[model samples]
Target: KIPEPAVAVDAVSITPCGEGFPQCDFEDSAHPFCDWVQTSKDGGHWVLGHKNVSIHGMGPS
Candidate 1:
């Protein structure tokens, strides 16, 4: 006889951001989140990018 799975599969539900937590879409502004700030200490910063990044075969298609 086959053994039953340890955990049962059930319906999944996702809670939208800002309801009880925070989220960022990185679409509207340079800053990703409300309290996020860019720093130059590492000589790199976060910037919004399109669906495809500059280099080919690197980013999402």
Candidate 2:
């Protein structure tokens, strides 16, 4: 059986991105944006972080 509360999960974005997503430098630097996936928390979920966005979860849906 599954435990009452499982371990904590977290996913960090790849390069060209900040902890909360940085600017793309559209007309200055290379690599506009970044993209990644998180599977440790809920079975391979897409993650796209914004400048000032927060994601909250309540266990299972």
Candidate 3:
């Protein structure tokens, strides 16, 4: 199964930052919900581009 919507979006946006974005030492004033990030891409037709696993209702703490 695919992951949650957020994770996929985060993964795609964050992966280019070195696969450890948010968790890494990269500086960012955005991405407050970086803790709940999970990303996976399904080349198959079952899912959309990248699928993510993450929580909702989270923001900068």
Candidate 4:
């Protein structure tokens, strides 16, 4: 499992991408943005990768 952190961010674009990984499990399906954030915040498993984004107003812009 990846190490969980305080928070995570999906600083990437959600628009049509050329290629990507297939949604595997629950986390992959739900968190189309960033899973590490909620996962870590929820006290679940830790995520290794970190997205550079502001935790404040992490909602749809």
Q: Pick the candidate with the highest lDDT.
A: 2
Clashes per candidate, residues 3 or more apart or on different chains:
0, 0, 2, 4
Q: What is the per-residue lDDT of model 1 for residues 1-58, given as tens digits with 9 covering 90 to 100?
A: 9988798769998866442223556675754453333347834454333333222222
RMSD of 2: 12.5
Stretches off by above 4 angstroms in model 2 are 1-39, 52-61
The per-model lDDT (C-alpha) reads 0.44, 0.45, 0.37, 0.43
User: If ranked by lDDT, best first, what sequence of candidates would result?
Assistant: 2, 1, 4, 3
Looking at model 3, the pairs that clash are 4-52, 8-52
Indicate the worst ten consecutive residues by lDDT in candidate 3: 42-51
- Of the candidates numbered 3 and 4, which has the greater lDDT value? 4
lDDT value for model 1: 0.44
User: Whole-model lDDT for model 4 versus the true structure?
Assistant: 0.43
* Cα RMSD of predicted structure 1: 12.3
Distance from true position, residue 46, model 4, in Å?
16
> 54 in model 4: Cα distance from truth in Å?
2.3
Model 3, position 52: C-alpha lDDT score: 59
lDDT of 4 by residue, 4-47 (tens): 77777758676762323223354555565444344435434333
TM-score of every model?
A: 0.24, 0.25, 0.18, 0.16
lDDT of 1 at 48: 30
Tell me which of candidates 1 and 2 scores higher on lDDT. 2
Candidate 2 structure quality by residue, lDDT tens digits, 1-61: 9769777669766676344554443454333434232437666445554444434441123
Ordering by TM-score = 2, 1, 3, 4
